[model samples]
Target: MKYDALQRLLVEHLNSRPVPPHAAARLARVRAAALARHAQRQRQRVRLPEALGRWLTAHNAAARRSAWAMAMVTALSVGYLGWAEWRTPSEADVDIALLTSDLPVEAYLHPNFTRDL
Candidate 1:
């Protein structure tokens, strides 16, 4: 409500007043002064290159740490998979055992069957 009242007041004053030529010049000077003050404050605050360098250094360090962690995890996963593969028995292992051993296949297939003496 206060904003609306202020806006109405501004509109009424603008409508009632004749346009002054010096108003534009005064406004331009005000804008320039505000901008100059803002620029001066910014210059007094921090140097741009130093701020950017600090940010970039932090970002690069974080990136390198993430990459190192990812590489380590990937290496561990690959090593685990390789170890599991090496430890597991395969079909070739079974075939080799069957070929090298003298166990009868029928005894495995028919354990319950018996011959009458």
Candidate 2:
């Protein structure tokens, strides 16, 4: 294959000429420095998840408190609505008030007359 021939040619060329000792040492030093940098980056990359977990652990109590507060607010709102519905007067109360009132029924029916008055 063409790739096999090219690989053989490259190998032959490299074998024919020896790299200088200084150049080989410099290449090794560069490789070691690159490997060190790569290892440090990998360590830093792996720490992200751990950092996030720590942050969540630190704020877990606050999150739980907020959830409890929301639940309390929801329960209070439902309780207040249930109480209001139960305490509301029916048509019987209206009839009794109309019969017992000194004012005319027409005054109760007037749009301008509020319950506050």
Candidate 3:
């Protein structure tokens, strides 16, 4: 059997069947060695650039600040617009006399009401 298959079989057999003290110690040593090999391989695969990491950190902070400033400006503009609209008078505030002054309905109905030219 392959090393991985052998390791898996050993683990399964050890878990299923009760082993004596020496066999248990031997299995523990094998498991530790396998785990150390896996950890070393993982460490070798990770690569990071020093300059890129610093640049990304600075760029992220600046972006966050800019976003906050933009949001504040937008909120202030909307609030000012709402306040100005609320303070302005509506059509209901016009004087009633302006609407009633130009009527000729009563004069038109009476035949005797005439204008001499």
Query: What tens-digit string does per-residue lDDT give for candidate 3 at 12-63?
Result: 9879967889988999999999999999987784446855676678788779
Q: Write the per-residue lDDT of candidate 1 for residues 1-114, one digit (tens) a residue.
A: 999999999999989977687997898999999999999978785689988887778787778789899999999999999999999999999779777767686654575634
State the TM-score for model 3.
0.33
TM-score for each predicted model, relative to the true structure: 0.38, 0.40, 0.33
The full ranking of all candidates by TM-score, starting with the best, is 2, 1, 3
- Cα lDDT tens digits for candidate 2, 33-59: 999999997777557888888787888
Lowest lDDT sum, 10 consecutive residues, model 2, at 41-50
lDDT of each: 0.85, 0.91, 0.78
Please report the candidate that would top lDDT against the real structure: 2
RMSD of 3: 15.2
Candidate 1 CA-lDDT value: 0.85
